[model samples]
Structures are given as structure tokens and as C-alpha cells.
Target: MFNDEPGDNETFLYKLERESEVQKLIAHLKRSKKTYVRRRAATMLGNIAEISDPNERRQAVKALVSAIKTDEDDSVRAAAIDALYQRGEDAFDYLVAEIAEMGGSEATERTATTLLTEWLSADHLEFRMVAATALGERGATAAVPDLVRALTDPAPRVRTRAAQACGRLSDPRVVPPLSERLSDGRQQVREAAANALGAIGTDRALAELVPVTQADEEGLRLIAVDELGQFGSVKPVVVLVDALDDDSTTVQRAAMLSLLELLTTASTEELELICGTVVDELARADIQATVPALLDIAADGTRRRYRQTAIWLLSRITGDRYRSEVIDCLLPAIDKPDEETAQLAEAVLPELRSPELEKRLRVYLSRERGSEEARSRAQAVLDEICDGSSGELVTTGVDYTYVDSPADYTNQHSSRD
Candidate 1:
């Protein structure tokens, strides 16, 4: 058996199949004079609540709950509460009753909230953070006001937990105060605040989140960008697009994912408008840097339209020099069963024309694995670029219309549909 020294709940509870261990620990809880021994005993009892016999588990829980209310040692009391936390909903009522008893009232409407409030005000920061978390786990709306108040606690740890509790409570009234914390002096608190607002999910929450996307701190900006992306509104598209250039690779990758989410249901006109931002970036020679991120989207076959649209957008951004890179990724996609992917690749292939691309197309045409229509479309693009005799590449099975640049995409900016 692993030594039950101090906080080793893992080892003490690891092999509890033997009833002797349970009897010994339960006896320790009853008779041990040392607070640390009794605390670990309480922790082990809670940990075994799942594996112990039904009668034994119930007895252990009852003992732990009693200890939580009466233990003189603060660590013992905290450990009992944490162990009960492991038991989940089974322990909620006992904890609530303990709160009522602690507050000296079962009749008060705010007994749970009141108990937690006192805990949050405790002089010790660790206790304050624990109380903030317990209030969140309780998931009571009445606790929102208290948690919001705790958001500005002098200790950053308390503020961070308070912000998290606000997210779990998901009360709209908490949005205003949580929004203020987006600019909190501490980065962890700011990130937590942004996440809390995202959970609240009110229109106002999204509006408040937009500004944090521009925050100087990369951690806050990353959270704000991720939360803003969930709204899928074009309003934050420009901000998300700007995040594509954030110096942190993590932030840049996050921005690309958000952009993909925004584009998933966007219309042709919306695509034009969103991709139009990339066009402006292209003007500044900034678009080429995103080639790797865009290729990630193109290669992710699970996101079919996203992959197709990414391939199309990449063809526009990369030009002939990246012709081989674009073709290498898209060529395999042409034979995919999803017709949208095949069609999109066929459309993009015309734009990526070069003698090297021509040779690859010829190879694909000769292969028996591709759909005949795909082969025919490949032949058409080959003819347009290789033969230099084209008004436009037309195939019966797929449209190989050359994707024009800004004009084709930008001209539709006025039409939302």
C-alpha cells in the first residue's frame, strides 16, 4: 500500500478492493488524533464511494459529510468538501444542507448563496477561490451577484475563479461586470472573463467581446477571437482576419479556425466580402503568409465545403509559383466521392494552369480510378491552358469556369444573397 502521508489521495484509494483497508481507514477517521491522518482518511472514504459496497459507500459518505460540518481542522473540512465534489450530484443535497446549517438557516432563500459569500470573504485566498468554485459547481443563479462581486477581489486567483463561476452560472446580469474584467490587470482573469461572456451568449455579450479581440495581450486576444467566432457573424470577420497575422502561431491558427467557422454557412456574396478582406491583405503581400493555414483547411476532408472553398481561395492567393503546392493538394481531392470537392478542384485547376500542371492533369486523365466526368473536366482545363485555344473550359459533367479575381468576387459585395 502506498503511504497515506499528507495529500496522497491517489495511492491511498488506488487498491481499495480489500475490506480491511476500508475498515482501517474508517477506524482512522473515528479515532486518529492527528488531523492529517484523519484528513487523508476522509479523502480515501470519498474516493472509494464508487467502488465500495453500497452499504459501505453510504456509510462512508455520511461520515465525510458529518466531518465536513464538524472537523476542527480547516484542511480536513476542505478535503471532505472536495471528496464530496467527486461524488457529484449524489452529494449536492448534503452540501446544501451543510450550507444551510453553516448559515444558521434552512428557511432563508439565500442560504446556499449566503454560506458561499462568507467563504469568499475569508481572509485566506485559497479558501476564497475554493468557495468561488463551489458556488459555480452549485450552478445557482442566485450566486451570480456574489460571484460578480468577487470578480474584483484583491487577489488575482479569487478574481479568476469568480470569473469562471460567472461562466458556469451563465446569467445575463453578470455580463456587464464580466465584460469589465476583459480589461482586468491580470491576463488569466481577462481570459476567464472573455470565456464567461461567451457562455452567457447574449447579443450584448458578443458585442462586448468584439473589443477584447483588439486587446494588446495575446492570451486575451486569443480567447476573445475564439469566443467571437462562435457567433459566426460577419461583424467580427475583419477582426478575426486581422488575428491571422497575430505574431503568435497559436493565435494565427485560432484565427484561421474562426474564419472557417464563419465561412461554413456564408453565401457567395458573404464569401466575396469575407475573402475580400484577404484580397486587401494580398495587396499588402500579407496573404502569402497564410498559405500553410489555408492548406490545412484544404486538406481537412471532413469539412467538405470548407476544404473546397479553401482550395479555391488558395488558388487565388498563391499564384503560379505555388502552382505545384496547390495542385499536389487538390489533385488527390478531385477523385474524392464528394462531388462538391471534385467540382471545386476542377474549377480551381483552370486557374492553376502551367506546363507542370498540364502533365499532372494528363496523368489523372489516363488513370482509371477517377470518374469519367472528372477526367473529361481535367482534359478541358488541360486544353484551355495547354492548347491556348479557349473562350472558357466547358465540360458536360462539371463547370470549369475560370475563377476571376477581385472583380468576380468583389462585384457581388452589394448582394447579400
Candidate 2:
């Protein structure tokens, strides 16, 4: 009783089915040989799969699976497969088994590869899209080669989905093909390829990602910067640091996050190598803008080692600028609970040659509320800078016993003037 138009009469058919026309519709679905009629009928069965009645839904699922397995019309089989996919995982096993059975036939040679390849190339866009997703959800390593081949499909959606599937598979062998898509004309495809390379996370994939960071697109650059952090290598460090100057704030933030991760994760030796390069970057006026971020790491670093490294790096990079520009930022770390942070700050103090160092030290020594250890640490720094004056000040605080306590001399300079 339905018209020739596909899916246009579904609402009408639903009304009729509620009026006891369900059997007639099923008979029409089973007898129809015309591809469009069968396609619409199979689509209608999917509508039934959504029914709240469990028994009715099972019957619809049974019909949809039977249509996929036995239907001779290509469009009809595709429509039935799409219907099952729309039902989500409830019908996932049937789809996988059908594709696998088709893939394995020797004489027919309609193996899963052959079947998925054909579905991905199907004339209808929906078939190609669903087939790509199915391949990904199947999550088989064997699907890698076929998904790689789909990377160049004529439709951008197919290519995009294929790239996404390759990511889910995370196969290193797919890296080259996925890498080529990083420059795909479609932005979605480019993103999918970059993400796939990230998921694979192989040396080859990392190599592929380096070039992606150089891509003219900001989104791609941001993705590459983020992914490169996982490498924990010299190259990613260099690229991420350069990205700190990127015009896009998003890219800059991503670069900062990645650089921080590298800083926190890299071994002392790795930090040494990375720090040398970072210091060189800091020397250039163009790269000086990144100093605030370095200061943040130093002042509030999450790890003791990273905090020490950050302070050390800041010291070297800002040594020339300290008294004039960076000293205000460096001065506070001397009081941190982390002794290394305090010590690193102390080490950089002499280099600054600021008169303020001696003034702050005297204030710290005179304070009755300070840590003896902190005061001791402060006194040692004072001794290194003030030389002979340190012994005269020794009697002012309990932290200094290394030099003779000049009681009369201490009384003269002990209080803050």
C-alpha cells in the first residue's frame, strides 16, 4: 500500500501498522525484489527495531538480519546493514559475522576485506560511512590494511571515518597512509589523521607528527603540539617551545602544557639537554616573552625536581635581566618549603649582585618567626655574598654557628634599621 518514494511513507506505514497492517507490510518486505522497495522496507524494519515491546523488537531485528544475510540486491543488503547499525550494539555481532563470513569465502573470495572494501566504496554515502565505523568498532588488526586503503576514498566522509578507524586500531603500519591524509583538503580528514598518528604513538607516527605541527592550520598545529608532549624527546621539546610564540593562543597554551609535561617527566640528563636549548631560546629577545611561564613553573612547580629545574633554568635565562627585570619574580622562591627551590634561588642570588639580597637576608635573620633551617640557609647565602660581614652578624640568629659570634658587633647590626 506504500508509494514508490523511499522512507517518505514511513509515518503513514507506522500508522497503518498500528491499525493491524503489520503482517501486510512484512509480506511486502519479504516479496519485494525492487532494490528501492526492499531498501525502504528494510529501513521500515529498523523503525520497528525501535519499538518498546521486547517481543516486537526481536521480530524486527530477526527480519533485518535475515534481509542482510539473504537479500540479493546490493542496495537492499546495504540498507539492512545500515538498519542494524542504527540499533547500536544489539545487532553488532550479526554485522561482524556477516562481514567476516563474506571476507572468508575462498572461491567466492568475498573475504571480510573484500566485503568491507566494497561497502566503503558503495555508491550510497551512508553505506560507506557505516562500513568505516563498523570496521573501527570491530577493532581488528586485520582491518588495518583495508582501512588504510579507504584513506583515499572519493568521499571525504569515508576518508575521515577510515582515518578515525585507523586511530582506533592504532596500527603502526597504517602510519604512512594516515600521515599522507594529514594534508587532506578536508579539515575533518586532516584532524582524524593527526589523531590516528597520536594513538599509534610509534617512532614512525611521531616522525609523521613533527611535520603536522608545521601545517598551516592552527588546529592541526595545536593537536601536534599536544601529542608531541608524550614523546618526551628533544625534538618535541624544541617544537613545543617554538609553539610558545605561536600567534594562536590555543596553540600557545597547548605548547605550554606539553612543554610543562616534558619538563616534569624528563630525566635530569634530559632536562639538562632540553634546558640548554631553552636557555638559548631565552637569549633571543623574541623568545623572552616565554619567561613568565618559566617563572610560574619555578614558583609553583608540581614536583620538587621540576621546581628545582625550573628555577635553575630561570636563573640562567634571566641572569642578565635579573636585577633589571626578573629579580622581583625570583625573590620569593627563597622562602619556599622546598629547600631545593630556596637553594636554587640562593645560588642565583650572587649572580644578580643586587644590594637587595643583603637587606632581605638581614630581615630574615632578625625575624623571630622564621625557620632556623631557613634562617641558616639564608645565613649561608649571606656569608657567600658578604664574606667577612657574615661572622660579625653570626650572633644575631640561632642558625649561624659556623663563625665566631661577635657579641658586641652583633648587637650593633642585629636589629633592622
Candidate 3:
């Protein structure tokens, strides 16, 4: 028997005396046969928990906790959790403990995830953060929408937790919202978004992270590059290649390492195709800046075909800018146990023919410290340059038409199938 007066805005504690009204609500919450009645009782107890009377607040909390533990209806249990949540810190602690305890059962786990999803909108920041964390830990895919919305919470910590939760869920649906967070004013939120985009590891998700690779923040760029390594896609690999020229040497190193990590996963054919696309798209100056990374790949690359592609890219892109360094990388490969690497180096060397390259090869040949195989390779490449037959060979299989400008190249390629 509860009061049903219309337009009565007085607090529940004052409208109905503490002992009588509270006892009735608790009885209905625990023993009511009707589901709606129990739901309403649970809600009232939550409102009552906000009252200043300590004894009444504890009684309300105890009733809600009982409803959570014993209520047969999911809605009733959810209502009880929401009610207990309003009881402040002590009840919130009890609520968390009860959810953890209930988590052992599949049905209760669903109920807990649903309730936590609703808590994402709670006025209290702690509730939002804890709910996000719990949903992520539970791997609640159903909570993704709420988590995405929470990505824009006024509090940076809430946004960070929500981004992390979205990542843990690994749902593609969160990709766009996470992308928006990449530019969040807060660095931690941006980093979390980048990390989440990487964790999702979908093409769309990985694509969202590309812009972040150019972020002004070095740490953010480092995170973007590192996460891109987890995915073995052409886009991320190409992005990593470009990152090789980053102003920050630390980023440059990370880009190189991520490129190597990608090699371990991406197929040889994929790397070769991406390498060709990279060569076609990158401006001459940008290509030149990548020499160090390309050399690193040429030296420590895992697959023979990829290493050869790296060498080919080095030849095509370097032109004459970093010829000395390119020669240094190639000469060592020529002496390695892998014959394909040796042959690729030897083939691409003649294409790199220049007075400078010729002089380097001659100097290399004169040095007794060089490996015999390396010296022999150098001799052959040097003879090609001197005999005036160096530039005749098309070592790189891709046909090249020189464009006056990068814009011309882009327009030509864009028009092609």
C-alpha cells in the first residue's frame, strides 16, 4: 500500500513516515508476486537511499541489494542496481561487489552489462568510468553504443576509459567515434583512441589511425606507428614507410621497427605491391628521406622477395641523392648467404650508375677488407658503368614514365585502372 497522490513533489521520506513506508516498500521488493510492483518498489528504495536519515538510507540499500540477489525478473534486478547506485559511495561499493558476485552466472552477467551501460550516463564521473571499465572487462558487445557516446564525455578520464572499453570490445561500429577522438584536446584521450583504433584492427579502424601518424605530438605519432604494426595491410605499411622521415628520430626508429614487424606478417607479394605503390606515390624528396628505413629493411628484412623489393625501391627512389649510403647497404647484401639478395643487389646496382656510385664501387674493390663475393659483385657493377652500358638495363620490372611534377604523376595514376 503506497501513496499515489498526484502532483505531490515532497520527498519520499517526508510524504510517508520513515518506518511504515520504508517497511512496505522493502516487503513489496522482496515478496511481491507482480513484476511491475517489485520494479517500482526497487526504484522507490533507490530514491529513499538519497535521504539524509542514515538508518533509512541503510534500510533502502539493504532492500535493493536483496532485490539484486533474489529478484526473479531481470528488470527488477536492474532497477535495484540503479537504486543502490544512488545511495552514494558505500552503496556503490556494495553494488560493485554484488555485480562481481553475480557475474559468475551468464544471465546475471547480461543484466550487469546492461545496467553498467545505463550507468555510462550517470551524473557521477566515477560511475561512468567504473561502468566503462566493467563493460570492457566483461567484453560486452552490447554496450558498444553507450561506450561510443561516452567517448565525448566532458571528463578526459571518462573518455579515455570509454575509448579503451570500445577497443576491448573490438567492434567496428566504434571506429568513427574513435577516429573523432584522435584529435581530442587531451593527449591521453587521443592516445587511447589511437590505441583503440589499432586494437579493432579492421581496415576502416586502421585507416582512421593514418591521420594520427602525422599528429604534431611525437608520442601520439609513436603510438599510431606502433599500433599500425599489428595490422599487416598495405596502407599501414605505406604509412610506416612515410613515418621513416619523421622529424623525431625516435619516431623514425619506431617507424622502421614497425615496418619490420609488418614484414613478419604481410606476404611477400603484398609487400612488393605496396613497395611499388609507395614508390609511385611518394615525392622524390620524400622518397629520398626514406633511404634509411629502406636500407634497414634491405639489411634485416625477413623474406627474400621483400628484401629484394626493398633493394629495388632503394634503387628506384634514391636516384642519386643517397647513392653512397644505398651502395653501402647493397654491397653487404651481395655478400650474404641468400643468393637472391646477392643477385638483386647486383642487378639494381648498375641502374644506380653514376660517377659517384662508380667511384664508391672502385673504392670498395680496392679495399682488401671487403668480402670476396662482395668485391666480385662490385667489380661486375663497376665494369657496367665504365663500359657505358649501365643505364640500359630495366632492373625494376615496373615501367616508368618520368613526370615533370608529383601532381602530374598523381593525375596520371588517378586516371589509370
For lDDT, the strongest prediction is 3
Q: Tens digits of per-residue lDDT for model 1 on 309-413? A: 688777777766576788888877777788878777877776776656765675566555477777777776778775655322333345232222567445455
Worst 10 residues of 3 by lDDT: 1-10
Per-model TM-score, in order, reads 0.66, 0.62, 0.55
Candidate 3 residue-wise lDDT, 245-345, digit = tens: 88998898777666656655677768766555556644434654577777876777665655776687778878566787887788667777787778788
TM-score of 1: 0.66
* Ranking, TM-score, top scorer first: 1, 2, 3
Pairs with backbone N, CA or C atoms under 3 Å apart (clashes), candidate 2: 102-110, 103-111, 103-112
Sort every candidate by lDDT, greatest first. 3, 1, 2
* Candidate 3 TM-score versus the reference: 0.55
User: Each candidate's root-mean-square deviation in Å?
Assistant: 11.1, 8.7, 16.0
Q: Which candidate tops TM-score?
A: 1
Q: Write the per-residue lDDT of candidate 2 for residues 233-281, one digit (tens) a residue.
A: 6777667777888888788767766766666677777877866665675
